[model samples]
Target: MENNLLNLRMTSKMLSRQAKRCQKEENKELEKLKKAISAGGTEEARIYASNAIRKKSERLNITKMASRVDAVASRVQTALTMQQVVRSMGITVVSMEKAAQSMNLEQISAVMDKFEQQFEDLDVQTGYMEGAIGGTTALDMPQDEVDMLIQRTADQDGLELNAELANIQAPQYLPDEAS
Candidate 1:
């Protein structure tokens, strides 16, 4: 996994460099096209302009492809980070269970209950984490209720909702009397 991530980072860097090179080439072609268009009335100029446009289009395509490669790298990085977090959570649960083994039955029951409650809290937190990572959340409250809740919170903080800012006019500059 670490090797894969390293390769991905390298690939991303290479793609970014290629994209920059393509952009520079595109700019050169655009400048040539502008020159050709300005120095008009020749068949050679027309041909050069057409070729420049095609080359610029190809360069833009390459830049877009590089951007896609970077995006893929970013997603892979996020997945790897989440995997680490999950592995740590699993280890924590195992350690907690092992510790409970040294306790009396009543103590074990109490520890188990505590672990259960902690797991429930973890589950809630996991849901929120997933929601944040996935870019969408499951809203238990209705839209109107959520709006009202937000309004109440805002009111508690002395905030005005949907209030427009006052429009202040800029001071007019006056010319010097001597001028």
Candidate 2:
């Protein structure tokens, strides 16, 4: 996935350069055609300038189309990649292809952004709750209250959790045997 993103980044950079070059050439041609039309008189330069303008416009349109295509493709690819990542990790995420077909790119992008933010929030909340649960600070709660909270947490889905802790033992750190 990272490789795909890197490839996309490189391709976009190349495409941007190409598009810029095309635009510059078109602008230069248009300027020359304008000067020719102004200085050489309409009867002599009209057809030449008209043809030049049409060709330049076509070139510019093609450049813009290419840019739009590249951008859409990149976004769709990223969304598909995100879906794959979720599936591989046994996590359920919104489908990118479906979103691409149904929603505008901006909407899909917004949803993806929100999804990422939510995940970050969940991570921070999980860490804080875990710390509170396992911390040395004693809670004034009754045993039943702690038990209910533990059970509630255990019931949640898609949390990448293992067996519930019966006791908060000090976590072990193993030295790398390969070292």
Candidate 3:
């Protein structure tokens, strides 16, 4: 895949160079055509214009071919990248399988249970902390005092507090009958 992609990139570069050469030749022909047209000779001007138009058309075709080559190169690069990712993932999967084979069901279950207990403990501690903080702080303070505290903290932290607590509505509680 890498070799193929490299070849494609090289081909794209060569095509682009060919296109640029054609464009330069076309420009030269166009300059000659312009001079002939300005010289006031109808027959010569007609011949030059026809040749220039043909050369311009060829240049356009070359440019189109170059664009196609570049697109193919881009696609090849994308494929190469995807191939690398898939190869890495395959390696990871094999390693995971090997590791899993070494671990017993009991061990896995114990680890999972340990993690669950830790998380439950953390949640309980978080809830307790929240309740304690709420009871001692804003919940027990006057609205103006809370606002003043918030403003002072913001000022100390170099933050501009533009939020209005009044604009935030509390969650509406619905009775079981309403539900």
Top candidate on TM-score is 3
lDDT of 2 at 34: 76
User: How high a TM-score does candidate 3 get?
Assistant: 0.53
CA lDDT, candidate 1, residue 170:
21
After superposition of all CA atoms, the RMSD between model 2 and the true structure is 28.4
Q: List, residue by residue over 39-140, the lDDT tens digit for candidate 1.
A: 784675676667667766776666566556555555565676667667766766776676676656766676667667666766676675555434322233
Instruction: Give candidates' CA RMSD values in order.
Output: 14.3, 28.4, 23.8
* lDDT preference between candidates 1 and 2, better one: 1
Question: Per-residue alpha-carbon lDDT of model 2 for 73-174, expressed as tens digits?
Answer: 455554554565456334324444556778788767866776686677656655654554334223435666565555445545433335565543322332
Model 3 residue 12 CA deviation (Å) reads 1.7
**Candidate 1 worst ten-residue window by lDDT:** 165-174
TM-score of each: 0.52, 0.36, 0.53
TM-score of candidate 2 relative to the true fold: 0.36
Query: Which candidate achieves the best lDDT against the true structure?
Result: 3
Sliding window of 10 residues with minimal summed lDDT for model 3 = 168-177
